[model samples]
Target chain A: MSVIYQRVALIGLGHIASSMFWGMKASGLADEVTGYARSAETRETAREIGLCDRVCDSAADAVEGADLVVLCVPVGAMGAVARDIAPHLKPGATISDVGSVKRAVIEAVEPHLPESVHFVPAHPLAGTEQSGPASGFAELFHNRWCLLTPARADATEVAKLRRFWKGLGSKVDEMDADRHDLVLAVTSHAPHLIAYTMVGVADDLQRVTENEVIQFSATGFRDFTRIAASDPTMWRDVFLSNKDATLEILGRFTEELFALQRAIRQGDGDHLHDYFTRTRAIRRGIIEAGQDTDAPNFGRGAHSTGRAE
Target chain B: MSVIYQRVALIGLGHIASSMFWGMKASGLADEVTGYARSAETRETAREIGLCDRVCDSAADAVEGADLVVLCVPVGAMGAVARDIAPHLKPGATISDVGSVKRAVIEAVEPHLPESVHFVPAHPLAGTEQSGPASGFAELFHNRWCLLTPARADATEVAKLRRFWKGLGSKVDEMDADRHDLVLAVTSHAPHLIAYTMVGVADDLQRVTENEVIQFSATGFRDFTRIAASDPTMWRDVFLSNKDATLEILGRFTEELFALQRAIRQGDGDHLHDYFTRTRAIRRGIIEAGQDTDAPNFGRGAHSTGRAE
Candidate 1:
């Protein structure tokens, strides 16, 4: 509930950064928070929303006199943003990033940082499909997991960053960069690619009109659209940066899909039932872990006790 | 809200049937509702939940004097259940079904019905992952679409069924059996297959432990797990009965996936970005149609302004 960092700089204000700014202010996580975005319109919007204590014109100015500078840019642009801010970073400041892919981010950002500064890459495994400055709120990271790929960063600095995330209400954990990529590939990246592909296929279906898909999407395809509706630029960068792991997971997914397809073709009902039953346990695990609600229908009408679907 | 049917019989006491019984009671759509499940345990649960006005031991007994007999069994078992109940169905009674697939269900049920009985096939495009008698609730079908595929049923009977569904808080629509199958294949069947495959791949991945997958699944994969956790027997039957349409859509999905994969491999950010942006429009369309919530995070914490993730 007190200031952990005297000054925090958020480079590239977007959903994650804007949320971080509001969350920090709400929780008194820092004394002063500054922000900078490449686009003038975004910076102007940030000012209008009072998103930060100071809205700077450039990344260098935002990092000036800041004890912590967090890169919230797309994965592909992390390096450029790091290079832009490196010269103006305060002495002994910690530079962390909120990129989805950890290994690529470290590769992209660490080299540009001065040895006096700490480079710790962190990824909060939390997001909605919406993006931009206005689409953020203070509690986006609450109860979410923030994975830190410290990878030999100074222990004290890593602990401080972990504490800062904890103060923002995220449970912090550490994992190796490569393992993080593999885990995220299974949990996020490949699933996103699959959702994108499914939505695209639905969009292209001539027999099933787009209006019909939207109307009848409540069954299952609607969920895919929600995932597919995420920020295109960020997701594009995610796939490009986490290419190998994502492709590997997707290859395995295609293999599994083929086996299921063959089972359907062969009328192997038993195989399909067994596979479906096993997957149910994973959902139970997610609910038990508090990552998702256990209420029926994804908690759609949980609060409205007598309401219809 | 007056009773539309004097006596309505539900032949399978699963999620759909039990929900219908409760929904009928909620809206006074049926004066008396009776239900029968093949499994004694399900029958017991129905009684325990007070799911029906009468819980019959046999399907024949359930349909003995009913004006409307709804077959709520899985697609694969419709034929056998229809054969069992056809002998007891009242003269002039409308026998409809709540199966997901239409053409196969009609083929399976129509041949078993007597000339005196009216066979009207319908598919409710609604459900949650949970199944069994206890999972049913009166509000399950509220605002959801219920697609009727009445091939040659009496117009008056079809109108009555549509009114009954509307009384239960559903929006009613009609389509040809073949088109229904194709639309559902795109909207439900293929998406489910894709979800099952993604979850299966996550389960089989050795490097990413099961614990990690479940813990980090708060991202896009969690939604897939919810879809994959749906009633296995019902889904198995759906795939087997709707094989042609499902396969066609899945093939198209594979083609689209491979194209996107190639884009990702070739570092074609433009293609990925463009595709992802197009999908966002579909989500907007769904929201505009009132099929889904526009609140951030799919309305997860929409009611609680500052709730944790």
Candidate 2:
């Protein structure tokens, strides 16, 4: 792939930013990449790992003369970072973000961006539970969806960013920011919170020893534990910033959960069976779409090579 | 491994029963194995797949001369199956079950068993979302846990059954039946119900199209779908039989979820962050316990090989 941008600057060196740096170099998406993080420790780690061509001491310095700037901070901190680096952004630079929640991020960052710089917001529908500088690889975004939500003005910049994401091995699409938030609330946000809640409840139950829960996690509960282990600060900002959509989806989840609870209470096996059968169709669709493989016990089959017999 | 039983009979031709057949054969744990399912189609499929040494026409015929009779049916149907096979069970034979709910199964099965036959109930903490005779493999129980809830069980019979499970490549432990129900309610039953409800909610949401949910399931939601895709009949029976424990855990889940929702609504980042951070410890416990591998994306990383870059 050809270089989509002459120079790229990544603000907030976390999982997404670190992956972008490696991916850009691996796929030749950018000639040079500069990076900065709010914490000195993270900057030192990034520098040690050779995460960027140049590890800038400050966000403004990172964006100096860069053709594209990507804000990879938590959603709540995007406004402050945007304001801090707004004055130093080059006149023709394309500015974007990899925030999970789009509508709130655009609202937070758009006011601070200079008119000379083009802002195109993006949310990559990909990640692992791991975070921070050392937790990324060039293939983190491989075969994942990178949703671009560009409000208006700057078709060329949006196109270039889309190409750059494709270069990073992500399939790119465009959507309205509001729709992005709602879709993500259903697909990612609410599911995460629910998982967290389940794990928390399991941890808090005094009658059932925590040791027992950990040992007998089996299939279903272990999956929830993995989801619940995601970065605390990042998810915290996501729920707070994407409040309405996340809350709305969670409301629907509670209502449906209540209905299922009632069915269980009443011994409504037919209703439970029918509802469970319907959910299987959605899983099949996911496998058919190439989003996930059709492996049974998918979460942890690789590490177990059963007994010699 | 040497033969643990002269003849073993499986009372259902579903995933667990079929896997037990293959595992027994692979390890040479049973000299002869027979199988029976309530459905003719399943029996036909079992025969087609060579799932047993002999696929019997009825449960009675399956257990006629067997030293060990395993009831591998759903919990709700256990009593009926036990009643059907009782008179035909070999004298001094050990009858076991692989039901998810133990107390309910014991209540349903014990009264029907003859005094000469020893009842040693067992539950394998192993399986995949896929079901039916063909969906099982010899390695299904490899390195997994098989829990035995023996109630005044004959020492020799319980010992023999434990050895048989060990031959099938599972670690064996003895736990109380009522305690088993409560522990499983927290670890497996409640988590499964939660996953099913979340998937159902996602499928029913009108605002977000099912196509979008399927396509962009991302990580968190996709995990739920995999869990929710488990056999509907098995899950229905689990919930219906383990009613009190499951309902109690779900009640706790709703309370925790409500607290989290309130925190999100009030923008209490501290509460959310603290709660999420604590759950990570339990995940770490699962990893360190070797119940699950410490993979960042444990669900589906094996099949994704990135681009040329």
Candidate 3:
């Protein structure tokens, strides 16, 4: 409810940063938030929309006197931004990142940060497919989990960052860096890649017109497209940065798909039925946890009772 | 609107059948709708819910004098139901089905039907993850596409069936049986198996506890689970019945997934970004087609702006 950070610097003006800015403003979590983006157009849009107290021309300028400088750029750009802003960071400031891949982000950014600053790797597990300065709101992080891979960061600083994220309306939890990457690989990265692949396959299939696929997509393919439509640069960096874990989970996915494919080919109804039934229970856990809704078609459109496809 | 059929019979009491019953009742599409389910419990639930004018103890009894008898059972069970009710179907009645796969359904049901009865196979491209008699609602088919694969049925009967679906609040389209199977394979079947495979992989991973997957699944994996959570018996029959197309699309899916996986392995950002970016256009088409909303998370929960995961 009160100011948790006197000065917060956001080094990217996309969905997460703009959302954090709005969330902070809505909750009165910070005194001033300075923002910067690689694209001048993005900075202009953020400024026009009043996304932050100050929209700086450069990452270094944004971090000049900020006590909390959060790297909100694509994972691949984290190191470069970190090196660029190292000299300009305020004394004893805490440097954190909202990257999907934690181990790689810590590896990419820690060496570039000055010893005076604290480096806490955090990942907020929430987002819509849309990405842009304007496509964010205060409710983006409401009831969402923000996992912090503090690694060896000072306990006090980690706690402070946790409090700040809490103020931004996220439930905070601490996780080991490698574990965080692996968990996210299963939860986000691999699923995203699979969705992208499925959507791409549909697009490439000449036998089925794209119009037909689009027209009949409401049941299943539509959900995959919403996920596959997420910001390309950010997802590209996620796969590359979290390559091992994502590939591992995807390997398992392919193996399972092949088995199910074999069952379908063999007309093994029981095998298919058992596997399908087993997976249903997992969704029950998610709905019970309030991580998702149990509404039909996600209670969208006409079936206005529950959650998504 | 006047009743399209003087007496209608729904042979199964499940999500689609119950919903159709309610939909017809809401619109007065049929004068008297009779219902029967193989499961007595389901029939009891339908009777309790006022699902139909009469709850018959047998499929034959339900179809005794019905002008339109709909088989809303799983694809694999269609042939048996068709055989059981063949003797009792009225001389000039129209028989239809709401199966996801059409080619196999036609082959299985056509031979059992008497030459006098018109058979017009149909599949509604709409549902929630929930199943059973209690899950049905009057608005389940509102504004959704109900695909008809009418293979050699009388034009008048086909038109009447289409009219009935329209009265039930659906947009109707006629597609070739084989083409419908392939189109649905791409849009629904393949996506479902892939989603199931992904969720299964998450479940089998011992290192990442189910709780972690449940808590962190809000963004990506959550959508997959909702899709994968669909009725197992229905999906099992679908895969067995639509074997060739499902396998073919999944083959393409595996190929694309491997290609994307390689891009991740080789750290090829351009390949990953291009594939991801290309897939995004498909969602825009789907949203524009009114097949789905652009609202975030299908306008569910807090982020009520656009569509699903």
Clash pairs, candidate 2, are: none
Predict model 2's lDDT versus the native.
Answer: 0.87
- For candidate 3, write residues A1-309 as lDDT tens digits: 988889999999888888899899999888999999999999888888898999999888899889999999999999999989999998899999889888888888988888898998888887777788997778778788899988788999999999998988789999998998899899888888888999999999998899889888756788788888889999889999989999999888888888999998998999999999999999889878887666554435542221211
Candidate 1: tens digits of C-alpha lDDT, residues A155-272: 9999999999999889999999999999998888998889888998888888789999988875478777778888889999999999999999989998999999999999999999
Residue ranges of candidate 3 with Cα displaced over 4 Å: A297-299, A302-309, B297-309
Q: Distance (Å) between predicted and true CA of A22, model 1?
A: 1.1
Model 2 segments more than 4 A misplaced: A301-309, B297-309
Q: What TM-score does structure 1 among the candidates reach?
A: 0.97
DockQ of each: 0.51, 0.50, 0.56
TM-scores, all models, native as reference: 0.97, 0.97, 0.96
Residue B212 error for model 3, in Å?
Answer: 1.3
Candidate 1 stretches with Cα past 4 Å from truth are A297-309, B298-309
Residues B33-104, candidate 2: write the lDDT tens digits.
Answer: 999998999999999989999998988889999999999998999999999899998999999999999999
Assess candidate 3 and give its lDDT: 0.86
Kindly provide the TM-score of model 2 when superposed on the true structure, using C-alpha atoms. 0.97
lDDT of 2 by residue, A2-47 (tens): 9889999999998888888889899998899999998999999998
Best by DockQ: 3
Candidate 1 local lDDT, B23-126, one digit each (tens): 99888898889989999998988898798999999998999999999999999999999999988989999999999999999999888899998888888777
